[model samples]
Target: MSIFPLDHRPDSSQISEFFQEVRCAAMEFVFPPACMMCRSEMPHRIFRTAGCTLCDDCLGQLDSGHGNACRRCGAPVGPFTIATDHCILCHRENYAFDGVIRMGLYRDSLRVACLMAKNPSGSLMSRTLADLLVDTQYELFSERAFHAVVPVPEHWAKRLIRPHYAAETMARQISARLKVRLATGILAKARWTPKQAKSPPVQRRQQQKDAFHVVGAGVQGQSILLVDDILTTGATADAAARVLKRAGASRVVVAVVAVSPPRA
Candidate 1:
């Protein structure tokens, strides 16, 4: 027997969707939807795309830096720089992941939005960013066939307070969009480590060394897309990639919403 009573009705889904749309219209009429990024009231917001909540201005700046980046680290480079394989910022640093794909640099509105994404309340924003990233870089991602998408796992302690973690949310979104298997729960945090942003770059690598643990098999030949919200020093990602590699993943490519700009 079909579990849903609506399953027997051919137009039930359409009816439900119609009502949902009507409800949204009513709610919007009473309380206009605001842009998630800039908090501007979108009283007459005409959605240019299905799931976008950012204002046109914010959306415009979201991808302004995607064109120029170091292929190796996904860091923004100047117009004249040759970044096909490496840029000066990343050339000397050895990262464990094969390559990187980023939506943009961590700055201005993008930085504010990424910071918002870390909170549990920013789940929708997180997924929206994920969609934007995939939509923009679908071609770049297509260059390599990923067997699975894995989010750099959250430690269990933190998951309690903020269950809607950004990395996992983005990973789930990318997995669906890219049609790759999601390797959720396969890799996990063995212990809690200080946030990479807080630690000095010198100590970052050491802190992440034994932070992650792989819990499954069948990754012997898998190519994984490792999803995260930010890439700062390449230390935490390197450590995660190291464990993923040791777990027999053939290759791991790092994908993030933004990569930290090279410090002066």
Candidate 2:
């Protein structure tokens, strides 16, 4: 008699994925695989959970978070430093976000990669970098169970000059990988503000104040993953998270491709 059950029904998603694979195979001969970072031709591509297309050498140059990092700010710390409670650097600082996650410190080749993502032609770079962040921090990311992914919105004035907006690209790509919703409309920059880097320390907080406004009501009791290209002084992320939390978001976790080394 029959050893296999005949009642098994194929899932539609599986069928759709099968078709997608066939299309990818058909396109392979036309466009040979290449590393997204270095643009070197790759003999083969192994799509991991993050769907990365980076060559091994280039991937090695971009340091993943293997070293000890501060639990609060996600900044790399010395081996001898204790970060159980909070990093010594940011312990006294008050941040609106519950925690932070980063791929690595903003230095060396990783620094170069971050800058590349800001260019208008950096869509793939932005997506690949976002995938790298999730690939490096898979375990911690899974535990967060984020309800939505929100990019730190850019003011319209900046968009008029350069419209790439790497943060939004990263957030959209990351949200797809996590099988979660991308909530772009939840938060917005209410007005254009001066660059944080140029602002004085005393004026920095004031500049960020009233900068963001919550536009959607869906964030109530949600856990959000706030995406940004870099984190410096925690001011911008803090400003964004403050509004998210005020909108009834239960938690706001900052995710960045790089964390600028603590200001000297």
> Every model's Cα RMSD, please?
4.3, 4.3
Candidate whose lDDT is highest:
1
TM-score for candidate 1, please give it: 0.90
Which residue segments of model 1 deviate by more than 4 Å?
1-15, 43-47, 65-67, 80-83
What tens-digit string does per-residue lDDT give for candidate 1 at 117-203? 988798898998999899888888999999999999989988888769999999999999999999887889999987667788889
lDDT of each: 0.85, 0.83
The true-structure Cα RMSD of candidate 1 reads 4.3
Error of 2 at 257 (Å): 1.2
What would you estimate as the lDDT of candidate 1?
0.85
TM-score of each: 0.90, 0.83
Model 2, position 107: C-alpha lDDT score = 84
Clash pairs, candidate 1, are none
Model 2 quality (TM-score): 0.83
